[model samples]
Target: MVSKRGRIDTFVAKRLQIPKKMVRNLIASEQLFIDGHQVLTADTQIDEFSLIECQGNVLQQRQRAYWMLNKPKGVVSATIDNQHVTALDLLAGIDKDLLHIAGRLDLNSTGLLLITNDAKWSQRLMAPKSKVTKRYLVTLANPIDSTYVAAFAQGMWFEYEGITTQPAKLTVLSKHQAMVELKEGKYHQIKRMFGRFQNPVIELHRESVGEIRLDDELGEGEFRALSTAEIHSINVNASV
Candidate 1:
């Protein structure tokens, strides 16, 4: 027989309107007990047969979350700071305490951005072995040369301030615009790469990552959580 009555500690916490985290902290600090047995983890999943008490403080569950933010230009992708604006600021009314960005877009660049508290999934996308190809649409102030296209695709090691980078996959989508894919990410990379040819970027947008494209319906500064199908597809495509 199953009942929703719950365990001793669980019943006590729920009845007293106390949070489980506080209950855990109480247990950790030796301020709580269950039938004279000391509690260790909050995950004890207690029933009416147990006992629970909190000397002081409250507890709450951490909400797990994931979201895509249509990051507008001039937003920094960091948390825990007072600045003009951070990508986390875009999460207003969103699940607070969500983790870091899966990949980064430059502050001056605008487009799709993924934020999730899931460390494992975040690590998967950021892993070097995954080699997830990120697609970017770049509009240059000047027309692109065909010779540059060949060299860009063949891989051009960008050297700046004594630091050199590996080659990237580059292609020309049009005369004044180009489509480039990079398996590796660096600080302000795309902008610097085009700077070498005296082509200043007029506009930039990240179109896709692997097989998942940013939803076209999303306006600037808008976002939605990715479906499970999209998440699975990233892993599947990375394997191929």
Candidate 2:
């Protein structure tokens, strides 16, 4: 209730069950605040994450939540799904409705997944201009050779999208496994990239997103809130 972002007067009125006139009066008397700052106008906009206070009493104070989940195979990166278990379903005792996946992995893919209620934070992390790197460990059906390294660096051309991929870094970890780092995520990019070599990706596990690595202690389907440093590492201009 009163969760959508809108003018402060409207939010305050709905949240407090008071008249709009009373909300304006509270603002005029300097008795209303948003995010700890005094509201100067009834028209001031506020989102669900905004901290609202009045007369030393908390009207609404919703802290931004960020989490890192070790997504297991077959779990869809969605808030809800009818045919499968969504990533949000794995979270316990948290407001799952307000959370969304930052960088989504396919149902068959596993590893590091970012979930948060802060839309701005997630948007910045996933923005193309941000160029945040995502690293993955891939197991292929065929042996990886030096050619694969050069091919990835050169970038692959997708006939359907009609756009070439950005230069990616690939390190051959073994005859059939390698580490891949990319600044962009396209539809089935990893699988399709391997497809160019006629090799199938049998396993794909993301290791990190930008500077936030998957916690070694988190088991599959387990998650923990992101640390202060981890949340700030995305280089978002605004505070969570």
Clash number for each model = 7, 0
lDDT of 2 at 39: 98
Model 2: per-residue lDDT, tens digit, 1-240? 123668999887887899999988998899998888999998998888788899899988778899999999999999989999999999988887578899899999999999988887887888888889999999999998999999999999999999999999999999999999999999999999999989999999999999899999999999999999999889653222
lDDT of 2 at 116: 89
TM-scores for all candidates: the values are 0.70, 0.91
Model 2 gets an lDDT of 0.91
lDDT of every predicted structure (CA atoms): 0.71, 0.91
Candidate 1: stretches off by over 4 Å: 1-60, 160-167, 237-240
Report how far off residue 86 is in candidate 1 (Å): 1.6
Q: Whose lDDT is greatest here?
A: 2
Write model 1 residue lDDT over 141-229, tens digit each, in one string: 99897777666666556555455555677778888988888886777778888887888998888988777788999888888888888
